[model samples]
Target: MMRRNDGCTILHAAVIGKCYSLAIGISESYPDLAGKRNEKGKTALHLLAAKPESFRSGSAYTLRGLGMKSLIPLLILRTIIYCCIPVLYKESQPVNSAEEPSNSASIHKLSRRSSFANYILGFPWLKEIDDARQSHAVAVMLAEKLIRREDWSHYVHTEFKVLEGSQFGISSEKKNRMPDPLIQATRLGIIEVVQEILSVYPEAAYTFDGKGRNILQIAVEEEKWFLYDYLMTSGTNMDRMLSAIDHEGNSIIHLAAHQESPPSTPPGVLEMMWEVLWFKRVQYDSYPYLWHLQNSDGKTAKQVFETNHASLREKAEETVRALANTVLIVSVLIATINFAAIFTVPGGFDQTTGEAIFLKNRRWEFSLLMFYLAGGLFSSLFTMGTLLVIIFLRFETEDFYVSLPCYYVINIISIFYSAVLAIVACCQALIVQKVVITDFRPLVVLFFIYGLMALVLMETSYVIFDYAYHLIRYCLCYRGQES
Candidate 1:
């Protein structure tokens, strides 16, 4: 029944402590505390909305894929242990009620606290935090419970009135603005809270923050890609929401084009490419007129995007140029080596016949040697030519969108093939020489060389393949749009 000086009740304290049992018990017994705001005008749910780590959507992605295999057995063990807690508690009870301590309530509280602590300690990898999956479940359940008892309309009105008062010079009793749980959740990318609020009162989606931005706009501004997509497809008033602009007269498209590589984007994606993808995604979904529509700053969405990405484009150009120069040097060296290899002849020319000695003694070996030598030389020349084309071309920002990536693909592939052929030709030359070996040393050397080649290829082509993936996707999307 008592509250802290900050106006926070025991319900708020329980939620903050992440004591889910106490929080749920409090909500069930004294539901009114669920809606009570502290001095800051934040209820228990409002505080929870700001904590992204409590939800699965906000959990670290490192514990996925391969990590899941290791976690499965631990999760199963935790479940088994959790199921046995109640049985252990009942079995340990005193046989006679009279034998129980006068301070039995204290023991019960201590037991509950100890059980929760044990649950947390079950996962060593979890550290001091609860398992994300379990925390997420409790979060959803608490959100659902609060939403069921909340009168959302009063909160919505208060938020709007706070904004309206500041705008029209009307006085209000509450000076500091309270954060709206749904809007705060959207900003933090906590989709569970937003979803729960909207499911109960879909009209809450239409509410705006102090800056006159609805949840959709906030999602775009904060780069909450998943939440933005969800809001767009949640079958709300799409047209109205899409057309909604902030007080600054910037639409969702402008907001989308505003930021680069927000935390939501994958780390490996190229910055310029990620920026372009975001702008294009927003452009495609929004009305065409919005593309050229000027915001309060007298800039269109495209202009804002280009302005924001100017440095990224320069960096991309420099990266491509540097890669081309380095690869060009390697290609030239490969071409020289392979060309000379063609003339030397693996087993030297027969002095009398004036032909390769291998041609007469080992005709197939000579032919294979010539084939690889010629292939390596030609492919190296092709690589050098492709790289020259890329280096000489003007690296305009638009060129990065497609032209540079196309040339890079050709350059990398050709150089890779040339290197492989050159190595294989050298191995074939050893065969033509019929070099003597005692302990399978030659085979071991060959395997070692091939292993080095594989490692080098993987190291070199990792970034190239990443770029090529996004490039291919971009091309397909462009083609589809045109069609």
Candidate 2:
């Protein structure tokens, strides 16, 4: 019941200490405490919001990735040993009938009885408490209780500007106004907290932070693509947010343009391509008129994009040139290797007819080897042609956006195909030459090669295909609008 000098209650202490079980217990016992603000006008939810580490969205360790995942089995084994030993020891002790029913000891007896009962129910009487799970549970529980009680409105400001000194509680005039939980969560990429707030109170999506930016705007500016995609797909009044502008007169599109390459995106040309794709996605999603709408600085979203992405585009050009040069060398190497393989067939030529000896003896292997070699040579030549096209093209900014990437995709695919064919043809040649028996070892090696090729194909193909899909969709939409 006692409070700290700063007015923080036991609930706040429990949350701050990461004692989620005690926090949950306290909140359940005193629901009103969850709604109470400390001296700083920050509720327990505000504290929870500030500590993103409490939620899964804030932490990097997933359920499968958690270190505890490996330790759970061992902990359970230890618990079984501890539980069984105590039961065995208690069974050996003499039952004292005279001391069984004392009035003051009944509670202790009942506690033991419940423990024994739980032991019989196939549950571990001794279990390790997972602080991460407990903390997340407490966070969700508090959010639900606070929202259901309508206590969240005070903490989620509508138009309050987060002052500079307000965070440190140094501004006596506005010391009571803490950061809004929704805005803080959005800025921190805590989608769980943001989702919980919007699920219960859809109106919270309308709340803005100090910059007059809502959760959607913040997501775009912060480059939280996962959160942004969720908001777009959740049907949480996202269409309305497209028109919302901040104090700087920057709409969601403008904010999207201002974001640098996301950390998850690869550096170099892919980063530049991702930035261009992101801008186009946002521009197409918004009303067409908003595309040209200028911010306070009199800069439209396109201008904002140009200003931010100029260096990225130039770097992307250099990267493409470098990549093309490298792939060109690879293509030539593959061409030469495959070309030499054709002259020296797997088996020596029959001197009488100048025919491949394996052509008649190991017909299938020879045919397959020849087919694979021909394919490899064709693919290598095609890749070389594409690389030349890419190398000679005008490296303008606009070309980097679409033309460069498309040509690069062709070059990469051709190179991959050529490499695979060459490797397969080599394996086939081995089979024809009988260098090694067509037994376990060769089959394993062949399988390993195919598996590795498939994995590389999956990894690189997805990004190329994704970029293409978005570009095509944007073009189609633009053409539809034009018509």
Q: Which candidate achieves the best lDDT against the true structure?
A: 2
* C-alpha local distance difference test of each model: 0.70, 0.70
RMSD of each: 9.0, 10.6
Q: What is the TM-score of each candidate against the true structure?
A: 0.68, 0.74
Candidate 1 residue 68 Cα shift, in angstroms, is: 18
lDDT of 1 by residue, 1-483 (tens): 899999999999988988765676677667678889999888898878878877766764322211123333344454444333331111123344544433121112224447566676676754323444455566767777777777676545443333453322222222224667888899888888888899899888877777677888888877776787689779898777777667777877889887546542333314565566656766777777677778889988888878877777777767777878999999999999999988888667878979987898689877988999999999999998888898888866566556665676788778878988888888878777876432477568768877777666655454445556745754565521111
Give the TM-score comparing model 2 with the true structure, all chains together: 0.74
TM-score quality measure for candidate 1: 0.68
Taking the tens digit of each residue's C-alpha lDDT, what string does model 2 give over 267-370?
67877877877777777777777877888898988899888887877777788889889989999999999999999997789999999999998998899999
Candidate 1 lDDT score at position 67 = 19
